[model samples]
Target chain A: MGMCPEHYIDYMHDYLDGDITREHEQELKKHMQSCVSCQKHMHELSDTVAFVKSATHIMAPPHFEANVMGRLPKRKNVLGIQKWLRRHPIIVAAAVFFLLMGATLMASYPNDNQFSVTTQPNLVVDGQTVIVPKGEVVKGDVVVKNGNLIIEGEVDGNVTVINGSYMASTAVVSGQIEEINETFDWLWYKIKKLANDAMALFE
Target chain B: MDALVNKRIKQVLKGDQNAYADIVNLYQHKLYQICYRMLGNKQEAEDIAQEAFIRAYINLHSYDQKRKFSTWIYRIATNLCIDRIRKKKPDYYLDAEVAGTDGLDMYSQIAADEQLPEEAVEQMELQDRIQYEISRLPDKYRSVIVLKYIEELSLQEISEILDMPLGTVKTRIHRGREALRKQLNNL
Candidate 1:
């Protein structure tokens, strides 16, 4: 029902390749009866196909056989057991069953988790004016090198500043803070870092 | 015969190494032709063809006996060619005159080369033109043209080689051939 007139392009293609089925050949002929542009296209396509087919005749290289022989793997001798298993249906079935069972068991088992950890160098604040915001926690190790740091929140870890002024405010601390001017023990350091970081935030 | 080929392959898998040489010898020429035509370089074609054989042998155990051996090997060759073609950028340089019949008008230069026989030289040149045009075609069509015309494989055989429906193979070959013809006409 949806059949439109077949184009000369299709006929040309089929004629060039000789792949046209009997039905299509008739359709092509019917279309060619009235269409001249496609017929010209078909003629050109056919001539072109003929021209190319006549021109190119590349041959394989001389050493093809030797090269192939060189690359082949040395055959391994077949063992009696492998041969026996190859022919034994029951053994093959059992082997397949066991292999699947082992795979299924492995898949069903939950794996134990081991702790994975990574450590980064402490944050360094240089002498440049650095601002720390209020009400934030500074956790883990932070190193400031030669910079001004303002902290106003909580620090749950270490804070080290080198040649840098640290502003601290009311904040919780669980770890130590060290600066060129002063060193605080773990609890004091944590509180100082947090306060400084929080204050720095506003500045 | 298909089963027999499969049995022979199985035998090769079972360490009958000599059986492999038989398979190679049987398929080598046809595979070589496909590769050579696809690559347009003899040395590369030889290498690709040989590799196809080696791969076929190594994977012999996985081969299904239901399919014809020729179809399987042809697939390998076609794939190898496609890989080679894909590695290159899309544009391919073509011999313009040979590609178009209009260039045949310039046959005067050929008449001057004394050492060449007239018919032989013309045939060689024409072959080169055809090959160039074929190579310039898109891979989908180029493969169909090569399989149908140069290899002279049936549409059914091409379908098997490509693992496509017979109707699809026929349509593609037709379309591809037409494209080649168009390209050549412009040449």
Candidate 2:
């Protein structure tokens, strides 16, 4: 019988584990008696197992429980909105999708009532008067409807007046000023306003 | 105990915030031991263990009552330990030395009055050597060995806690034992 050291080492582990059959156990025991290296290997393996089994148990530091409890975040109310969203991810996703959809639809839909206005302080409209107040400087487009434009300041942009008039005193206008009083222009404006209001509802 | 833990969990979910303390107290020692064995640093272990409990508390509603609470908590702790290990630079020699001093210092003090000076020192040295070697093991093997030997968990339970197959756990354990044997031989 060829008794290899490596083979014996494997058998030694099985033997220690009590998984070896009687026949194999007998063979291994016989080999151990004749093989010095295998005997040494078995002894070392056994010692290692013993050391691991006998290792000292280290307890957690004192006041470990108190420390942990104190450090714990204040328990959040489980019924909070964040917890509810966590529990119902599908509902959260739906809510997000609807929110984004509404924003996109609102952005794309035309609203004639809502006109883009320049944020420059020079373009000021108070009630029916679009006034470029004295000593003020405007640097963008100005559109006014159903109101008069009073200019006593410097204007550097286009001024459009619909169903209204413009008056300037020592005011510098850098862009064209137009008044839409023709029937065709009035008819076009009304048609465009009606179409926009209808689109706003779908949006 | 499991039934009691489950009941506490139910109370906690139902707005009894104080009930969580029972759960933390029940598992703190075991979780700390696992962290200590894995990190080989008392301070890091405490921090990680405490963090694990806090995370578990926050996510308590997500915890399925059908599952064993111990397994769930252990998984959280083991994951936190692994993340910490990965983020750290590999410093086997430095970590082993620091761990040796910290661990040996405490044990040596305790054993000083009980045993002869020379014998206590020798025993403490041996324990330090074992700890250093254990710390030197690869993360995979170290985790399995700590869970199996120190934590005294069953192979099946370890498998569940680690989210690993039983066969893989066994293989790692076998490899870990072999590595430790080599370290012991050198000693």
For model 2 the interface RMSD, in Å, equals 1.7
**Per-residue alpha-carbon lDDT of model 1 for B1-187, expressed as tens digits?**
5666776788887778777776776677889988877776666778789889998987776677776889998998899888977864444333335555666543332222123344544565655655555666777887877887788788889988888898888778767766765554442
List candidate 1 stretches off by more than 4 Å.
A1-6, A12-35, A55-59, A77-203, B1-7, B90-124
How do the residues A2-114 of candidate 2 rate in per-residue lDDT, one tens digit apiece? 45746676677666545678988999899888888787777887887777767688777878878877886765554576667878999889999867755654554333433
Model 1: per-residue lDDT, tens digit, A1-203? 12444554655566655666888888778877777766676677667556645644444556666667778987654444665776798989998986775565545332332211113333233346443346555557655555666666666676665555667776455766666533223334445556899999999
The TM-score values for the models, in the order shown, are 0.55, 0.59
Candidate 2, residue B58: how far the Cα is off, in Å: 1.9
lDDT of 1 at A193: 52
lDDT for A53 (candidate 2): 66
Error of 2 at A141 (Å): 48
List, in order, the clash count of every candidate structure: 47, 0
